[model samples]
Target: MTMQDSTDLPRDTSRVDSLEDKSLLLVDDDQPFLNRLGRAMERRGFEVRTASSVGEGLAEVRRAAPAFAVVDLRLEDGTGLDVVQALHGAREDARAVMLTGYGNITTAVAAVKLGAVDYLAKPADADDVEAALLARPDALPEPPENPMSADRVRWEHIQRVYELCGRNVSETARRLNMHRRTLQRILAKRSPR
Candidate 1:
C-alpha cells in the first residue's frame, strides 16, 4: 500500500497536508546533502524545509509543527539529537529520524530512547529514507549489518580503497598493495547484498 494509505499514518489528509505544506523539517550540517535530500523527498510528495543547525531546526519545528523530521547526528551548532528532543517536546506526534555518517549501536539505541523513530547512516538514498518513514510504529526494521565485519574486513578494506581511488581498479590495487586481479577477485566475491 502507498504510505498515504497506511493505517498507521495520521488519518486526516488535511492535517497531513497542512503539515506537508509544512510537514518536513530536515536538519543537517551539510548544505549540499540537505538540499539533495530535500529535493528527493519533495519528489516523493513531501513538503520539505531545511535547517543547518540544531537551534534553527528547533525554531522551525516550533513554528511549523512538522509531522516528521529528518535530523543529522552532527550539526554545526550541536547534535541533531538535541533537535529531536525539542521537536518531540513541542509535538508529541512528530516522528523524528536520525541520520548520521558514523553508525553505532550505542548511539542508535540512545536515539530511540530519546524519542527518535529510527537511525539511518549516511550514503542512504531516498528509498532508504522513505522505507524508514513508512515503517509501522511497532515494526521498525532492524539496522543493516555492518559491511566491516571480521570475516569481511579485508574485502571491506579493499572496497574502501577502491572507493578512495574513485573505483579505478588499478589505482585501488596500487594503494592497497594488491595486484589488480586480486582486488577484482575479492570484489567479485563480495558483491553488495
Candidate 2:
C-alpha cells in the first residue's frame, strides 16, 4: 500500500501540551529511536508527537497542526515522501526535514523537489537535526558538492545500510548484497576510541 493509505490511523495526544507552542511531528519506524528523539525535541522547546508509521504520523499532523516535521524516508509500512506531501498540504509554512539511512543524490533531490527543507542522513545527532530546523530561510546548509566518492563510497554505502538496518550486520549485509563476514571485516577496520 502507498504511504497515503497509512495516514488514516489514530494518534496520541499526551505530549501535545509540552511542545513549547512550536509543534513538531516526528515519524520513524523505530520506536526506541523515536522516544529518544522525541524527548530531545521536546526539551528543545518543541511539542513533539511521534508515530511509527507514515499513516499515524499524518494523523498527528492533522490533529496537532505542527509547524515542523521530521520524517524518515523509509517507514515500516510506507515511505516518508508521502508524509512530506501531506505535511505541506496541511501547513504551507510548515518545514519538513527528511531523515534517512539511505543517502543518495537522487533521493535528496527528490526530497527537495517534493518540499523538504533539508535532507539528513541517519545517525545524525539531535543537535544536528535541531540546527537544521533552526536555520534561517536563506541559511540552509548546502548539500555536499558530491556525495559519492570513489575511494570511500563503498564504506559510506556500508555505513548507510548498517544504519538503515538499525546496526544489524546480517540485515545490512543482505541489503548491501554482501556476505556478513565481509561486512564485519569492513566494520572492524574502522578506528575505535
Candidate 3:
C-alpha cells in the first residue's frame, strides 16, 4: 500500500454517491495481481474490467469509459498512461490511479498531469486502491504508514539509474557520481527492509 488503507478512513455514508457509476478499469501485465485486484474491487462493489496491455485497455475505454481506473505504469505493450489519457478524454470526471513497481518522480508527475488522482507503487493492496479511488478531490491523502527509509530510497534511486544505464556498472557510477566498484557492491546486496 502506498498510503493508509481504507480501514484508516472514516466510513462516509455518502461514499455511495461518489461511487454511483461503480465501473472500474484495471490494466496490468501481471496476471495474478490483476486477477486478485479485480476480485477485490468486485467485492468492494465495483464493476471491474481487466486488461493486460495498453492496447486492450484503450480498446475497453473506447468501448465504454469507466468511472474509475487503476492502471499499471509499465505494461507489456506500452505505458498505462495511454489508458489513463483515453479514459479522461472519454470521461472528464473519471478518477484514475497509476501503479508502478519502478516508481519514480517523472512518471508520477506525468500520470498526475494526465488526470490520475494518485500514483501508487506496486504491491498496493485493494484497500489502498479503494481509499485512493474514493478519496475526496479537495482533500489530501493520508501519509504512508511505512514510508521507505532514506537508505532504501537511495538504493531504489541507484537501482533505477542502473537499469536506465542498461545495467552497466561504470555508466551508472558515472551518472550517480559513485565509484564503479562501490556501485557493484551495492547492486550485489539485497534491498534494505
Candidate 4:
C-alpha cells in the first residue's frame, strides 16, 4: 500500500473485475454512518444499495436480492432482523451481518438464527463488515488500527443518545443525567480524540 498524499490512501484495487456483479445492501437509520459505509463499500467494488429502515430495506430486497448485506439491529420502523429475514426469504445465498451498539447474547443468537452470518458491535469499520459479508470461517476480525480513545468514546455515546432523543439537548441531557449547559457545550465542540 503506497501513500497517496498524506492520508496514506490505498491505490484503487479490487480482488475481482469491475464487471463482477457484487450487489450489496446496507440498512441503518443513522444517515451519516450509512452514507460513509456505502461509499466505502462502493470503493471496494460493490454495487451498493442503502436504506434507513426496515421497510426501505425490504423494499430494496423485493426489487432485487443482494449477494451481501449489512443491517443495523435497531431501526426507526422495525428491527434489522426483519430485513435479514426478508433477505433470507428472497435469496438463499444472501450473506448478511447484523450490527448493534447494544449487544446481548439473546439478540446475537436471534440474529444469527434469522439469517445473518455474523454479528458486529457498533463502530465496526468497512473492512470488518466486508469480511463478515464475505465470510470465511477461518478468517478473524482485524483489530482497528486506530481505536477510539476514551474521550472519543464518550463523545460518540453522547452523540448516539442525542440522536436517539431527536437531537433535543434537554432531553438528551435529562436521559444522560447531565446538565443542559454542559451537554450543549460538549455538542458545540469538535469531537474529542
TM-score for all models, in order of appearance: 0.64, 0.65, 0.76, 0.63
For lDDT, the strongest prediction is 3
TM-score: the better of candidates 2 and 3: 3
Which digits, one per residue and each the tens of the lDDT, describe model 1 over residues 65-170?
6878899998878888888888888888878889998665556776888889878988778877766765667664665665446645555556666766888999
What is the per-residue lDDT of model 2 for residues 1-193, given as tens digits with 9 covering 90 to 100? 6565555876432222333357788999988889999999889888788888988987887786678889999998888998888888888878889999867655777788888888898877788787766666665365664555664666766676687799999988888889999889988885221
In model 2, the worst 10-residue window by lDDT is 11-20
The weakest ten consecutive residues by lDDT in model 3 span 11-20
- Give candidate 1 misplaced runs (Cα > 4 Å): 1-22, 140-193
lDDT of each: 0.78, 0.79, 0.90, 0.86
Name the top TM-score candidate: 3
**TM-score-based ranking:** 3, 2, 1, 4
Segments in model 3 whose C-alpha atoms lie over 4 Å from true places: 1-17, 159-172, 188-190
Candidate 4 residue pairs that clash = none
The list of candidate 4 runs beyond 4 A from truth reads 1-19, 137-193
Error of 4 at 142 (Å): 7.4
lDDT of 3 by residue, 13-49 (tens): 4233454699999999999999999999999899999
